[model samples]
Structures are given as structure tokens and as C-alpha cells.
Target: MFKFTLKRFGYMLLTLFIASSITFMLIHAMPGDPLAVAARKLPEQIKANYYAKYGLNKPLLTQYGLFVKNAVKGDLGQSLASPGRDITETIMKHAPISARIGGQGLILGVTIGILLGIVAAFKRGKWPDYLVMFIAIVGISVPSFVVASLLQFFFTVKLTWLPTTGWGEFKHTILPTIALSLSPIATYARYMRANCLDVIGQDYIITAKAKGVSNVSLVFKHVIRNAILPAITLLGPQVAGIFTGSFVVESIFSIPGLGQYFVSAITDRDYTMIMGQSIFVSALFIVALFLVDIIYGLVDPRIRVSSGKR
Candidate 1:
């Protein structure tokens, strides 16, 4: 297990390096100068000095080397969009808001989705199954922003049950969380339903049924236990994505989170902010994937044993 973990950690580092390199190159390749906003009105000489100050005047390779070197030292540099603001510090400030919404959304979505899936599987060919599928289909078809709009219209505009937008209280969280959850709910439902049906038809399941195992045990100890693995696999990136923030949901609801910063960074061409956020998210994603691998092994010992041999 230790060897397996060490191997995965090494792979994570390699993946993060590649991702950061690609992001750095792409950000530099983007049309328009990173200094355009900051240097637009400055004299030519002053602009040149400004460029030098941010090291934007350097060659791409040298810039990349400096970025990597600074990043390794935990200095992601200042925001070109908002001068004097450290990119790392900026992310740290707003990450909690995104995390809170995302964590709630994921929990609500996955739990309900798995339940709907199990119901759909067990009640196959019945109205209950059809109803669950219909809901899942709607969730799948509608985008989160649109859902956010509808939720706002009904809950805030019409019923006055919730605020239209803002980020102070718990009420502000509900609409965004629900909007974000819809897609995952649909995804987990479809995958879990399929997995459950496949598990149900397996030879072990048949034998257990023949031996008069209770339906409850058949569903819980056998069916759900096996069927949930796919959902667990899907969970890792979703966890990472929370930190990246929900760009649309945050915008629609006026929540001040990391997503808001990212969107503005792109719009303003803040190179450091963009690259820092991207690298941070990539690292988070890699870490989450690593944890998923560990959890995957724990959930199914066979995977660990097979991987150990490899």
C-alpha cells in the first residue's frame, strides 16, 4: 500500500507539472498583452518599465521558469488586474465561500441522486422508475444558470421566500446549491441506476436470492454496496471543482467567490491570477484524484491487491 501511494503521488506531481506548463504557455499565447489594462495610458518608456517590473518583458521560457520557481516558493505574484494583490492570498480569501456552496451542493445532489437511482432500478418498468428518469432527464437537459434563473423567479420574485441575490446568509446559498446540484443529480442517477441493474443481474445476486436472502439485505449489503463505486469515482473531480468555484452560479447570484475572481481575471487578462488559479485548481484536482484512488482501494480490496502486484 505504501508503494502504491508513493507511485500515485509521483504521478500526481508529473500531472501537475504538465498541467501548469500547458496553462502557462496558453496564457502567454492568448491574444492581447497581459499589461494592456495596466499600461494602457502610461508613456512608452513607463510601459516598458512596467512590463519589466512584472517580468512580462521577458522571453516566454524565462517567464515560465520564473513562474515555476516562484510558485514552488509559494509566491504566485501580484494580480495584474488588481495591483498589489497577491494571487494566492486572493484565492485563500474567497475559497471558503465557494467551498461552502459546493460542499452542500455535492452532498445534496449525490445523496438524492443515488436514492433516485436505486428506486429506479428496483422499480424498473413501473411508474416510479419512469418518474425518476423523467426528473433526471430534466435535470440533465437544463443548465445550471437557467435553473438559477428559474429558482430566482419563483422563490424570490414570486413567492418572496428567498433573496434574489447576495452572499451574506444561508438563504443565499440554497438557490446556487440547488442549481449546481441538478446536473450531478442527473449524472449520478443515470450511472447508479445502470450499475445497480448490472449488479442485480450478476450470478452472486441470483444465488443470494435463491438462498432466500431478505430483499432489504439484497438491496443494502449486496446491491447498493457494489453499485456506489462508480459514484465514488465521479466524486473526486467534483470535490476539486468546488474550489474552482461555479462561474455561472456565482455570477447570477452575485456571490463573491473564487469563480468571480477567475472570470474577472480572464476578462482583464490578469496573467498571474489566471495561471495561479489554474495551477492551484490543477494541483487540487490531482490531489483529489489521488485520494479517490486510495478510497477506491479501501472500498474494494481486490483493486489494491491487483495494483500492488502491478
Candidate 2:
């Protein structure tokens, strides 16, 4: 297990390095300079000074090396869009909002999805099963942005139950959370249902039933524990995906989160902000994948035993 964890950590670091390099190269390759974007009307000399000030005048490779060095030292540099603000501090300020919404959505979606899946599996071919499947299909089919728009219109504009947009207050979180969670809920439900159905057919399940195990105990203890393992595998990557994807949701709702800044960073050609966010998100995703691997070993003793033998 220790060796496995160490190997995964090394892979995570390597992945982050490759991701950062690609992002840096790609951003530099794009048309339109950050200086031009940041200071459109400034005189050429002033722009040149700004370029020198931010080390934008340096060679691309030199800039990249500096970026990597500074990043290693926990300095992500300043935002081109905001001028004086540190990219790390900016990310810190906005990440919590995204985290709050994403966290709530994940928990809500997973809980409801697991419950629905259990019911559907237990009552396979019945009305409850059909209903759950139907909902799952709709949830999967509908795009999150469309869901957000409809939710905003009906709940905020027409019904006036929730605010139209903006962060702050519990009411503001509901629409966005529901919108973000819909697809995940559908995905988890489908996977869990399939896993549960497969588990039900396994020899141990039948043996437990034949041994006169109570229905509830049999389902919860034996069935859910084994069945939910696959779903657990999805949770880590899903967490990173949720936070990254929340940009669109945040934009629609006018929420003050990293997503909003991420979008602006692209359009404004804020190179530092873009690179910083890219590295941060990439690191987050890689770490999540690493943690997921560790979690797999923890949840399934088979993996640990297999690793040990190897």
C-alpha cells in the first residue's frame, strides 16, 4: 500500500508538470498578446514597460522556467486582468464559493441517486423502477446549462421563489446546485442500479438469502456495500469535474466564483490568471485521481492483497 501510494504521488506530480507545460505552450501560441489585451489604449512605450514589468518581454522558455520556479515556491504571480492581485489569492477568494456549491450538489446528488438506485434494483421491472429509470434518462439527456436557464426562469422570474442571480444567501444556491447535480445524479443512479443488479445475481447474495437472512439486512449490509464501490470510484474525478465545470453555471447565475474569473481570464488574455488557473485545476484533477486510487485500495481488500503479492 505504501509503495502503491508513493507511485501514485509520483504520477500525479508528473501529470501536473506535463499539464502545466502544455497549458503554457498553448497559451503562448494563441494570437493576441496579454499586454495588448490588458492595456489596449496605452502608448507603445507604456505597453513595453508593462511587458518588461511582468516579464512578458522575456523569451517564452525563460518565462516558462520562471513560472515553474515561482509556482514551486507558491507564487503564482499577479493577474493581468486585475493588475495588482495575486493569482493565488484571487483563486483562494473565489474557490470557496465554487466549492460550497459543488460540495452541496455532489452530496445531494449522490445520496438521492444511491437511494433511487437501490429502490429500482430491489423493485426491478416494477413501476418504481420504471420511474427512476425515466428520471435518470431525462437527467442525462438534458444539458446542465439548459437546466440552469429553465430553473432560473421558472423559479426566479416566473414563480419568483428564488432570486434571479448573484451569490450570497441559501436561496441563491438552490437553483445552481440542482442544475449542477442533475447529470451526476443520473449517472450515479444508472451505475449503482447496474452494479446492484449484478451483485444480486452473485453466489453470496443467493447464499445469504438461502441462509434466511432478513431482506433489509441482506440488501444494506451485503448488497449496498459491494455495489457502491464502483460509484465511489466516480466520486473523486467527479469532484474535480464539478468544480471546473461550475464556470458555466456560475456565469449564468452571476455567482462570484473562480469559474467567473476563469472565463474572463480567457477573453481578456490574462496570461498569468489563465496559467495559474490551468495549473491549479490540473493539479486538483491529478490529485483527485491519485486519492481515488488510494480509496480503491482502502475500499477493496482485494486490491491491497494483489498489490502486496506483486
lDDT per residue for candidate 2 within 1-310, as digits (tens), equals 7887887789888988999999999999998777765677889889889888799899999999999999999899998878899999988888899988888888888989999999999999999999999989999999889999999899988999999797789989999999988888898899989999999999999999999999999988999999998888898778897678788888899989899788888888888999998888888888888888899888887886787676
How much lDDT does each candidate structure score?
A: 0.89, 0.89
Q: Ten residues in a row with the worst lDDT in model 1?
A: 239-248
Best by TM-score: 1
User: How far in Å is the alpha carbon of 63 misplaced in model 1?
Assistant: 1.5
Put down candidate 1 lDDT per residue, 60-156, tens digits, no spaces: 8999999999999999999987889998898888888888898888889999999999999999999989988998999989888899999999999
Q: Cα lDDT of model 2 overall?
A: 0.89
TM-score of each: 0.95, 0.94
Off by over 4 Å in 2: 37-45, 308-310
Query: Residue 269 CA error for candidate 1 (Å)?
Result: 1.2
